[model samples]
Target chain A: MLFLKRYLPLVICGFTGVVFGIQYYVPHKASEDLLTFINDWMIIIFGFSMILALASLFHVHYQKIRRRQSGWGFSLIVFIAIIVTVIIGIISQGETVDEKGLTSFGWIYTNMLVPLSGTMFSILAFFIASAAFRAFRARTLDAFLLLFAAIIIMFGRVPAGEYLWSKIWGAEFPLQMGDITEWIMGVLNMAARRGILLGVALGAIATSLKIIFGIERAYLGEKE
Target chain B: MRSIFHLLIFLLIEGQAFSQELTPPKELKAFDAPYDSGNVLYLTWKGMPYDSEKVDYIVYISESEEGPFFEIGRFKSNTHFKADKNWPAWAWKRTTEYHYFEISSFIKEGKEIPLENGKTYFLKLLVTDGIKQVKSNVVSAFPKGNLFNLLKLNNLIYMIIFSVIILWFIARAKKRELFLRKIPALEAIEEAIGRSTEMGRPIYFLTGRLGMSSVSTIASTIILGEVAKKVATYGTEIKVPHTDPIVMSVCQEITKQAYISAGRPDAYREDSNFFITEDQFSYTAAVDGLMVREKPAACFYMGYYYAESLLLSEVGASIGAIQIAGTDAEHQLPFFVTTCDYTLIGEELYAASAYLSKNPVLMGTLRGQDVGKGFLMGAVFIGTGLATLGTITGAMQIVSFVLDWFKGF
Candidate 1:
């Protein structure tokens, strides 16, 4: 019984896997209908999962409030926000995404969310500048090459480099540099991208094979 | 009996005369030419000339100079007959062999005529020019190859290059001497964990938005296990927030295992690995909140990420955490490059755990990747040089030919 309980899901998954796999090669109408039914079931399962997650969130925060924890006030604030949003969303006949009905959600998202998110994201600009200053020190040959590449890329992407060089060398120099930049990006970057893509492809294939063959079952969690 | 016999003999004689005197339409050669592809020939001929009164023309084709011909295709009672294009659509399959074609005209009350294949038959065209019949001289031509079969040879070069790279990697991996550089994002793991331990603040490790089985996520989980072990040994707090339930469960197990391995199983907290909402923005918001509230000393973001990368990293930075991020998303790399203290640019994310763990299997794979990269670099150099030299010297024709040959499907 214990073995059955533990392996039951795996067995069902395996059966479904084989069915779906073979369905690809089966041109019959019945096989197509079966695959469609399975796809619909998957969507329903995803919906249920979402509901369960929301419930978990509610339970956790509600318990925090009931216990009068130190963060109970914040929990209350969060609970009220969620409740009001849900209520407005439901009461508006679920058409809250429309222009007029979206006022409340839109206000909250724009005022409270977008700015905070955008501000957080903008910090990356400053961080990049600092990191570049420190990390691009050319400590080694590889570092120097990386720095050179970065400089060329930055200059090539912007128009100022061309303008400055065009004035210095009359005209042809900037054009030559532009050509070099294009060559670097087209050849060097494409090569690197291809290499990375190939590795990713192989890794994905190996991992997928492991999953399909049941060699990797870490996602099922602990045996018990 | 004599009257019946007289009627029958009269009818029989009339039918025989009609059969013998009726002829196909005249001037069957004056039709318009059909559309022509390079390999297929389509010819449209004028209707037979004999059908100016009450008959129509039927076209026929044959493969020899002799008497048998049959109808291959048909058209309406118009001034044209188009040859089928599919008959000779390829140059190699087409022959200069001569074939015969003819047309026949017939009226409703006249005798029915039969057409055969492979023999030239005289054809007469009949038309309702509203009054009488017109005849045209017969014209003929042999059917031959059309122009549609020119081979598209350009894709072969790409196939050759792709195969060479793949083969080279496999061969090098088998030999086992491919060198891979250490990724710095992975190198900072110990330092980040040690710093968090010393500071008495919990360490926060997020495996970005990828699910449990993604390569970057797997790499993150492995590194998380290692980091969790160190934290457990030092009796430091560790929090792992996951966007995927499956990943949360896996991380919990890995964390527990790590604690046990470190001989500090008692310090393991199962709840430390918790699932946040899977919505990209919501997860980022939740994680940002966690960072603000917990103010972890060390923050690690390792997996696949998108726009939320900057948001999470920025929050970590604001919390003054020693932030280390690794991902394979090229688009997100710029954000990570700016915000994270250490960022792994593409394949480096996969290389990180392998580099740190020094697992033989993973190392072998990394070696394979390096071999692939080297082969790609060599190809790039050769291709670029050829293209550039070709362009400079106006030798683009040769370059194009070579490229076409090498690039294969």
Candidate 2:
């Protein structure tokens, strides 16, 4: 049991990680075929894991119902939703919509899922404004700089800013807010973004090497 | 007077020569495409003038050079130069004078036929400007497989060197203590759990909306192990809602192990790491609803995130939760910084695991990463100096060598 749980997994992980890592540099047909084969297996595994997910879901909601917990009605709703969706999916042969019109699965998905998702997405607009209000309070020098930049960007994106600039300084003004905005976004922002990207890449590499070498097993539920 | 006479004479001769015919496609050759399986051929030709907009080159392919060649492709002249190819700067000279084309398939009567390995194919190039067509001699090429992609040699070499550096550091760290600089977010974990425990409210930990395949998600799960262990020790409820089932399963195991390691095996709850729906915003909506109702004391968002980052973090902030977020998503960093109490920027997300655990081997990897970053920083500084000097001084040739080398790196 220990071997199956611990050593075997490590060996498999180490072997596959190193193999795939090397496979990236090999342009041969065999290596490419191996990648395709492994990807197919992953897809198969993902399909099988859905059973475990559904079982967990059923267990959680079932317990809530059995105990007659608060908001047990919601748990009951979840159970009904899952069952209805699954039945519709299986009966429709996994097709959401047919040639003629909406199938049973399509009716549920188009009616229930899409609008709910849209509502959630629309909430991001309000969140962004609220977050921006917090961020642009100008409590510190950094906040002030952020506020300044944000104001400039907001102005530069519109034609009114250009018109005001031309009115303030003649048409032949050497500097423009548009140019400054471009410099900030293209030069300053790009340089900082590139630095962060490099750090992210290096970090990813370090973590991957740790995993492949078996130095990182915390993800395996191991202590170190 | 003599120069004008010479110019007229030259114009008379050159004009007649130009009016007679267009330049024929010359030195047409086909070879196996490099850095690929033996399934394509790269064809190169010369002799067409760069400004010839009206003229185009037609490429034909066949098994035999004698007859029955079919059209593979056709394109305008002065384009598809070798200099514009996608190969790395250091890999080839990329002769700008020659036009090149990659032909992997031929369409005959609307049916596509692919070139195969172990097959010798003949190709011919013809230059035409609506009226005149000039044909080049046939060239044959045999497609053969390559064992390695030399184009990615620099990438492979860097990987190997970085791996050796990390391993060396790991070995050294085993003998001596390695110093890991402070990341404030790692310190905040214990406090957040304590607060949650005191309030008797659960701490929400999300492993972002990514699967097990992503490195960010993997890092998040590693950090999840640490966070869950702390929660278990504090006897605080830790709820992990997952969008990916595989990740949820992994987190469940991690949570269980953390409980066992904390000597609170009975506190482990299987439903703590539950799967929400996979649809992105739907999952966000669900998590938002849950947070509003339950009002968790602390919220930990770790892993890759999308636009929904602000939505989740804002809700946490509204609930007065100590929201600690970590992700490598640079675009969303600003939102996290604005909303969350603590945000781990980019690489710090990965380093949090090592910092919190203080395991020598893992810490060594962090040290190695820092050193690697230092090296990159030095290279970027020198490269930028040289490039700026070249641009300002108009001595581009002096910097081209350095710039191209840096570009390859």
Candidate 3:
């Protein structure tokens, strides 16, 4: 049981990882075939995982409704939505739109799901405003710099900044808000982003190597 | 069929009306394109006749020239140099003038038939001056699947070096104790968990919306294992709302194992880790609802996030939850920083598992990653210095040549 549960999985993980890692260097047809085979396996695995997701969704809501929890009504609504969507989805061949045009499933998706998801996404604009109100506060030196950069970016992103700059400065001034904004974004921002990217890339490589070598078994529900 | 019949009639009339002649392109050659997939080959021809205003070239491909051939594509006479293919200068040698076209596949009736490895393909280039047509001599080349791509050799070398550094550190760690600097945010996790226990409110953990495929998510789950163990130790409730089923399943096992480790196995509820909808905004909305309703004493947001990072954190903040956010997603960092009490910026998220676990293997990997970052920082500084020096000394070509060696595949 121990071997079957732990050692076997780890061995498979290490072997498969090494193969895929080497695949990055080899452009041979055999390597390409390996990639395709692995990708197909991942797709199959994802399909099975989706079943678990559906079951989990049902379980959570079912328990919620059974206990008459705070959002019992919402849980009931979830159950209804899942059932209805599933039926329509399977009947419609799971396509939002077919050659014949929008089916009942497509209509529900277009009308209900799209608008709901869109409305949820649209809430981020308000969230950003509130967050920005807090973030851009000039409480400290870092905050002040952020505020200054934000102000410049906000102004210079529009055409009026250039027009106002040329008008107010009367063509003698060497610097423009637009140019400063560009410098901040292109040079300063790029430098910071690249630094973060470097760290992230290195960390990613380390993490992948650790996992591939079975030194990091946290993903397998073992040591961190 | 009808179009060909009409073209035949039209060409017969045009042939009588004009006497301008066309010649085959000079110095035609077909060869395997270097530093590319085995499926593609380059066809180059010199000196397209400039005597006519309306000249068109057509490319054809076949197994053999004796029988059928199909037009793959057509293009007007234009300068297509070998240098323009965008293969790095180190790999591509012939920068001289020639009209070049990359032919990877033969198309017929909207279907592509890519060159199979080890299969010889015959190709022809035809030129027409809108009056007469001429065909170039058939050229043949066989595609060979390159056993190795030398362009990525530098990357492979760097990876091997980094792995060696990590392995060396791992071996060293087993022999001696290693010190890790205190991360205040990680320190505050215990305090936050204690608060949740005292308040009798559950702590909420979000693994973001990404799946296990993402590095950030993997890191998040590892951190979750540590967090779960800590939660078990403190007897604080931990509810993890997930976006990926595989991640949720893994988290379930991790949490259970943590509980077992802490001698509180019976207290570990399977429902502690639950799957939320995979839809981005939907999951965000659901988490927000949970935060608002449950009024969790603390919220731990870890892993990759998009726009919803702010939405969830803002709600958590509004509920007075001690929100700690960690993600490698740089763009979302500002949002997380604004709304959360503590934010793990960039690679700090990756280091969190090692920092929390204090396990030698993970700690060694983290140290090695730090060393790798140090090397990168030095490289960047040196590259910048060399570039500035080159600008001053007018030795930019040498600097650029050195820099191109570091550029990726």
Candidate 4:
């Protein structure tokens, strides 16, 4: 039974994998229907997964409250928040974000969640500036080049340089400062991007080939 | 002085007679070359009555109006004749300046009519039969410099620079000197796992939303394998909470392999690697709960990540665990940079596995990437120079041709 359970999922996966692989080449209605059925099954599975996660959340917190853990009061608050939202959601006929019900869920999402999330994201700006300061130090040849390129880009992107100097000697040369910046971005930056993309592409192709060929069979959970 | 006075008197009489007999063609204009070679001058004139049957028209070109008109070419019938096209390619390489061209038609079997250089030419056509021909009215035009020349020059410089960089990188990688710099986030895997073991708290490895196929996720998995080995060797527990089911399974094998490699096959726990929800927010919530409940000593977030980067990082931070994160997504880099103790940015995420393993093949690939980067830098230098020079000289035909070739892709 253990062996069957271990191998059965692999076999089932292999069969389905081949079917899906062949579907890519086949243009028949039956193949299309099969793909649609698979998609529908995926949606059903996703729905069940969400339900399972919610149940798990409720169980964990319910136990926490019952056992009266150190943060049990916070768990109770979360429980109350979730219960109230669900009840309001159902009673308002799924009008969770409707203007009539805006004072409740809308206020929570807008005032609490959105600002919290935005604040979390905005914290990165300071971090990036600090990282840049540390990372862009000219400790080595490569670091020097990186720092130079970054500074050029920063100067080139803004309009202040042109206003500061309109001419070099007698000739007009306002946009000359951006020349190096453009070159770095258009050439050096693009090449690095292409190299990364190529490696990623090859890795993706290899992994997909492995999956389609049934050489990889890890998605199935533990055997009975 | 006496002969000049007689000639002037005779020219005045002839000019008066010529003006009274023939009306000049109206709206005569010269346009710059439309395409291809730049030296061609376009001449348009209001057609005279006798233009249709005119078999031969005499066109004279000269540098000045005073005298010495040279016959550059003769148009047998057509109204338009390009000076550059008619002349040898090399001859038209001189400076672009103003020149003059005039046309006049002859009467068959009539005395050869000489056209004077000083007078403005009118639209004149020769009505010719086998036996006879007549002159039509004359026309005039003035020419100017062609302007679309510089765009071509800029393009050439760009192409050369781009090609040079790409080639340079490829060559350098081939020569085997492209050792990419070390990334710390990748280097800390074993240390993080060992720390977890000493602390007696399980290590938590979360491959972000990216599936197994993602480059970041693959790098993460490779690192995970190495970390798992250390955990197994130390008889330490580790849990891989995966957002992707596919990645979860990969993690399970990786964990299993680590245990086997560490000579602790019996210590491997399959349930330790399990799929949490795939939805971004839900996954974050679940992982947050796990962090709170399990209080893992170390957390690694390496893969594609988004807004949840902070939520996860902050939760892990609150637990007082050491955290290391790496990703290539530009938007998410900032989050990892701020929140994680060590974060790999952009290409470093892709370079992590090779850096950690130091396998020759992976190292070779990294070397290849450096070669590509070098080639790019060289191209940038040359392209900028050519474009700048082309602008200064205002001679852009060659540059434009080069640019057109570069833009072929």
Candidate 5:
């Protein structure tokens, strides 16, 4: 039982990982067909997994309410939101959940979900300001450089920066703030970003190799 | 007698008009398209009438060299130079085969010509406007797919070479000592946990919004196992609020295992690792609220993060928590760097897990990756030098060959 429970999964992981990794290099029709078939199965399996997660969520909230935890009211609200949303979703969706159908589910998503998400996202503006204020302190060489770059970027991204530059330099200053900003972002930032991305790619490949060989099993719960 | 003389004069005028002739197209050729399925036959012709108004071209295809040809397409002169574009979809074959093509013209007469003569095959041009028409020579091509594309052969070679190198390094690294540079963010994890323990406050871990399938999340989970073990040993309470359900369940097991391994199984609480919400901002809001209310001494943000990175890190900073963070998300690095005490940049996040755990296999793989990267760096430097020399000397065959080889991949 223990072997079937643990070793079996690892074996399956190794087999699938190797097969899919090799599939990228193959251009044969049979290889492509098999890849497509497995991808479909994955989607179906993911659907089932989501259901399991949903069950776990409900159970967590149910326990919270039952035990009268500190935020039990919020737990009750979560239950209400989920149940109502699911019921409306199934009822309004005739045969499919595609937005092409004019349904109350779409209405709920557009009106309730979108606005709520947007409101929450808009709050980031204030958080950015707060973070910027703290980050812009010039205590060290690195800090001073960061502060300078941040100031230049902030000024260059808007029309006001260009307008101020033109007014101060009589329009012949040779470099506009916007142009400087564009150069900094396009040349300096892009170059650094690409270098980091290359390293990240190599790291990802190594990690994938480790997983395929079953060397990285910490994610599988524990090291044996 | 007078009517007969007028008819004779009209006949002579019509004969004179019919004497005009069209020049036949020159240097017509046909061949199979390279690097594709055996379906396409390419045909090219020169000497299309640049004026185009005097003559129009029609293309015909035939199965055999002899006999019946059918009109595949027709166009105004100069409309198209290549006849390959008109390969009929119905004529597409799985096997490499041959087809014959003919280029002909239809000269317009005073009367409207139907353009399609009922006959299936004939190499004849019609004269219109009382003019004479001409036909071009027929062209034949045998199209077939090659067994292998030389264009993509380099890609296969590179893949094999890289695989061998990585495997060789891994084998070597397993038995020998490999030097690894220090990552400050990973080193601070222990100090952060100890601080939390001394402060008598809970340590909070925020796994990013991504699920377990992402590489960053996988890396983060490995690091989490180490952190949880340390927390268990220190007897500090730890809270993990997850945005993904599977991550939450996996984390719960990891925390439990850590506690068990620490010989403090009684101290482990299942409720400590629980799902908050999957919605991005909602999860961020919940974490922010937790940071304000619970005020954890140490907060670790380790995984793939996006817009919510700044929000979470700033809140942690505001709460005076000892914040340690790591991710492969480059854009979010600036935020984490500014707000968190220590930030792992790019690949450092990946290296952190293996570095902290010191698992022989994981460390071996990391060393192998370094070897691969070193090889790539050497290749880049040498290739750049060779290319510069090649350009200066105007002897670019070697550089071109090298570039083409790399481009294939």
Candidate 6:
């Protein structure tokens, strides 16, 4: 049990990491075959872990309902939702879950998940307005610059900004609002983004090194 | 009988057309393909003639140079053939032994025959016009691996340099003192915890809608540990809702450990860190509801987020919460920057946890990363100067060479 809990995971991680790391340099048939086999093994392990996750979820909800705790009604609703969906899904499919086929599973997914996801996404518009109101305040020089940039970008995205600019400075005016916005987004924004991406990439590489060397073991939980 | 007589007449005319003068492909050669197993034989011939449409070229393989040969495929007038796919097991048996191949041209009506199993052979080419057939000279070459791949030599050198630099910095950091610039957001963690403790409101930390395997999520979890320790010390409640069960488990463990280390194990609650549904929108909705109801004083959004970044941060701001957000998700950065009081852009999220915890391993890795960034900045400066000079002086050869070298990466 001790070995399984501690050394086995470390051994597996080290072995797989080394093998896959070296696999990149070797474009041989054996390396390709091993990659395929390991990928399949990963899929199987992921499936088992998913089952464990479901069990944990069910256990948590069951405890909440049994204790009749705060929001116990919501827990009952969750149980009902799961049960109805599962039963309908099983009955519609007879056994298998065919994603493309017009079964109850597909209907439930398309009707429920897709719209709910879109609604959550659409809710972002209101949030954006609220957030913009807070962020666009001209309190300092940096804040004023951010506010100016935000206004220019907002104006440039719509046709009214270009129209207003042309009316004020004539049609022959250089650098319309749209042009300024494009330059800001394309050049200045892109440059800053690239710098951030570079730093992030370096951090990721360093973290990977830490993991490979067993220097970072926080994910293994509390140090015994 | 009348139909058969008409078919005979048609065949006689076709036979006459097939017997017309047509030249054979020249400069026939066969060699093993480079950077591949010995199974593949690459064959090439001279260009097609004007009358190539009237003839069909067939590829044949045999074990022996004797009479028997098997047709592998037929083409109109291809000058080269990659004989890798659709070969027999014996042909691609992963051996250094060579096999024979023949390129033959015949009338379109020529029947393809299978070869008999036998001994060793070589390559041959046969050209036939309905009645007569001519055989060309044979050629063969064995496939083998080279000791080194010269193409990827530059890449190998770069990898070694990078590895050495990273290792050297890590070793130095483990032994020697290291300096890291202070991140304001990380420093504000204590302030956020203190505010929640004063207001008697819970602290809500979102680990993003990602699993534990994600590096960003790992950073968030580490940050969570630090925050939990402070909260435990202050006896302030903290709620962590996770979309992934594995992450929830890890967060629960980290929170428990934090409380234990803070000597507030009695105040720690297991129910505080719990799993929400795996569904992204459902998880978001649940968290939104929790925010509206509980109205946490301090909200920390950490890890990789998608569309939900704005929704969560905006809601937190609406409740007048002191929101601190950190993520490597560049697209969502603008949203977090707009909503949160303090936002850690990209790698700052990773560095924040390291800075807060003062974990030697993390600090060393972070310092190594800074070293890498410094090296890159220097290289970029040099490269830019060279490019600008090359462009201005109309001498781009050096610049191009350097660019090609970098492109090898």
User: i-RMS values of the candidates, in order?
Assistant: 9.0, 1.1, 1.5, 12.8, 3.2, 3.4
Instruction: Please list the residue runs of candidate 5 whose C-alpha ends up more than 4 Å from where it truly belongs after superposition.
Output: A94-103, A170-174, B1-155, B379-400, B407-409
Instruction: Summarize candidate 2's per-residue lDDT along B1-409 as a digit string, tens digits.
Output: 9999999999998986676467667778899988787898999876455236788888999988786899878888878889777466566556678888998888767889888887999999888888878888889997877888887787787788889999999999999998777788889999999999999999999999888999999999999999999998999999988888899899999999999999999989889998777789978987888899899999999999998899999999999999999999999998999999999999999998789888887888888998899889888899889989999999866677556644552
lDDT of 3: 0.84
TM, every model: 0.59, 0.93, 0.89, 0.52, 0.77, 0.76
Q: How do the residues B95-171 of candidate 4 rate in per-residue lDDT, one tens digit apiece?
A: 22222233332232344443332334323233343345454333343323332333244343543353344345444
Error of 3 at B192 (Å): 1.0
Best by lDDT: 2
Q: Considering the true interface contacts (CA pairs under 8 Å between chains A and B), give the fraction that model 2 also has.
A: 0.81
Q: Per model, how much of the real contact set is kept?
A: 0.09, 0.81, 0.79, 0.04, 0.46, 0.41
Clashing pairs in 5: B107-B128, B108-B128, B108-B129, B109-B128, B109-B129
Instruction: State the displacement of the C-alpha of residue B17, model 5, in Å, after optimal TM-score superposition.
Output: 22
Measured with DockQ on alpha carbons, how good is candidate 3?
0.63
The best candidate in terms of DockQ: 2
Instruction: Write one digit per residue (lDDT tens) for candidate 5, span B1-409.
Output: 9999999999987776554346655555666554443445555555432324555666666555574665556655544533233322222221112223333322333332222312222342221222545666676665554334444666667666766666676787778877777888888999999999999999999778787778899888888888999999999999998887778777888888888888899999878887777788888887888788779999999999999999898989989999999889999998998899999888888887679877565677677677767866787677788889999999775465555554533
Candidate 4: stretches off by over 4 Å: A2-4, A25-33, A59-73, A97-107, A165-171, A217-224, B1-188, B199-202, B211-229, B237-297, B307-409
Error of 1 at B243 (Å): 3.0
Q: Can you write out model 3's per-residue Cα lDDT over B177-262, one digit (the tens) per residue?
A: 78899887788899899999999999998897788788899888888888898899988899999888889988998889888988
Candidate 1 lDDT over residue span A146-182, tens digit each = 7899899887777897776677877855365577688
- Candidate 5, residue B56: how far the Cα is off, in Å: 10
Please identify which of the two predictions, 3 or 4, would achieve the higher DockQ against the true structure.
3
Task: Score chain B of each candidate by TM-score.
Answer: 0.56, 0.90, 0.83, 0.55, 0.66, 0.66
- N/CA/C clash count, model 1: 46
The lDDT for every candidate, in the order shown, is 0.61, 0.88, 0.84, 0.59, 0.74, 0.73
Worst 10-residue lDDT window for candidate 1 chain B reads B32-41
Candidate 2: count of backbone clashes, pairs at least 3 residues apart or interchain: 0
**Ranking 3 against 5 by DockQ, winner:** 3
